[model samples]
Target: MTDGNPDRPVIVLVHGAWHRPSTWDATRAALAGLGYETRIATLPSAGTDPSPTASMYDDAEAIRREVDAVDGPVVVLAHSYGGIPTAQGLTGADNVTQLIFLSAYLLDDGESMYSRHGMDAPADTSGTFPLPENPGLALYHDVPEDVATQAVADLVEQSLLSFTGTVTRAAWHDIPSTYIVSEDDRSIPTALQEVMAAHATTTRRWAGGHSAFLAAPERFAALVDEIIRSR
Candidate 1:
């Protein structure tokens, strides 16, 4: 309960593809306990959005607008490739106090998600893909079993162009940043996650699957609260 500040405003959560806002259920509860407000935003049609940059950026803009409507610095959180959207959307948003990347796809200015993961990166098609159009597509296989099942049920067809689209700028250049790596992530491989978060100004590690907020909500929430307190 280090959240001594009753006016810390809010922590904005941005989820990645193959998942929805409900995916952050566990973590949200944890933040609630520390006297912080939390918002989990779903990318439009994680199943159907076609252009990655536009879809993701637009979604992030909605988040930014929501945050700006508030009264203080926001703790923007991005999970997996959601980092791509958060990065591009908050390029000049001065209200953002910190950026938290949870086992996410963080890129440099002008980099694309596709470039980072590579064209051959594994896709957990168990149900992540095959939207009504690509039936049998595995989008979130690396997520835990329970999460994967729910993800398959509500997942949307993601835009391949999002991955192909490059971020025009690097927003984290100015915002203080922290990265949380799941040591046992199945989808992004902990090794690569470590490499990806190498440049983060601050880093934290937890022993859980990629969706630790769901797999181990309390711990994830505690970390988020801690970040808000420090900032």
Candidate 2:
């Protein structure tokens, strides 16, 4: 990152399930070099409770703390289940200028994460690791080969509590939202990603896998940079 205008603010990151704030290290370094500040948030993963007592709002409160710290409006990027928190986090955040979904799930009011895909009215409550409570698995076969293998290895069961949690506020409609769809995403099929993200005002496609930030950080960072700089 060369010297950038300090007045433009920065882009903030929110990662998905089974991940941590540290997972965005590479992307954060790339952005900071470009003169942007980034705060990568870690969500509650399987470790908090293998007993499965996590809710998306619980994750959102974690994100909201970061959003509240921004001095100016920011570009909020969410990956996978992280979008649930992002959507909810942006609700009362005056500093949140935009919401960007990266191969993520976006639901409407009263809609739980699983309900969007018709997986189940309420996600399963079974206690399992890696598979969690999602019905028949929500992961897909279209993700890039190398990325998918690592993704599988990194997989951990997300809380059934989060999947079944309902969001009262839908931030995408209120914010100038964008969608960066990964064509090779295996977890969520590309077709479904497109259809589900149709409501975003701006959408871009990338030829990467679900973990593009890990597999291709620079490219993903550049796209995020462009979004933030344009503001």
Candidate 3:
């Protein structure tokens, strides 16, 4: 597909499950310092929003709104569960020039976060899902203790339905894409990430955990900047 326009694209940030738009604060700040414009999607499955039963489709629609709102070219950067929705959201969105998947799931049409990962669709529990075993150690293994603790505390109840919803459109098929693989990710196995990343046009590997955006902010930001400039 064409680049659409010669102007620099706005960076659209999409956070994974259990996370709010605020989750991208550090990355946003770093990108801002580089004079890059950015926007984060407010996901319905993120828990704080009213809809507790929101599905991945809802998340995709939410992200689509943000992408369509931008006046110029757009580049989507999706993290973790954010990948599914962001990919669906960009369906036929010509303004979106490229997609950057960061330790993110890349599913095919008719596949889902649950099926692809072999996760049982979570039950309809009254409260949020339990934090992963040693969440801090798993998600932010390389991050500072305080930072990891704070990040965990900030997580909200992600809707279980989100994982079950199947992807209707795999936008990567039509758009240029890049995948960033986390070598030490404890949440999603590095091998699985590599399998899904095969769908991307290109891939890069880095040493970090699932939350590399936080643990390796400068390096992550630099990579993002490099991707943008190279485009």
Q: lDDT of each model, Cα atoms only?
A: 0.70, 0.72, 0.84
lDDT of each residue in 88-160, candidate 3, tens digit only: 8788999999999999999999888777967766666333445577777778888878888899888887777
| Minimal lDDT window, size 10, model 3 | 1-10
Scored against the true structure, residue 217 in model 1 reaches a CA lDDT of 71
Best by TM-score: 3
How far does residue 130 in candidate 3 sit from its true spot (Å)? Answer: 3.5
lDDT tens per residue, model 2, 93-193? 77788888999887777777767867674435645335534321344244355654655566555666776677788888788888888888767789888
* lDDT ranking, high to low: 3, 2, 1
lDDT: the better of candidates 1 and 2 = 2
Between the candidate structures 2 and 3, which one is better when assessed by TM-score? 3
Q: TM-scores for all candidates?
A: 0.80, 0.83, 0.91
Error of 2 at 137 (Å): 14
The residue ranges of model 2 lying beyond 4 angstroms of the native Cα positions read: 1-5, 45-52, 121-157
How well does model 3 score by local distance difference test? 0.84
C-alpha RMSD by candidate, in order: 5.4, 4.0, 3.8
Best by lDDT: 3
Tens-place lDDT per residue, model 1, 1-231, is 224355775788888776677777767778777777776666753644442334556666666676676576788899987888787778778888889999888788867766676664235322233233431223333446776676566655565445555677767888889988887776677888888787678888877666777666777788777776776
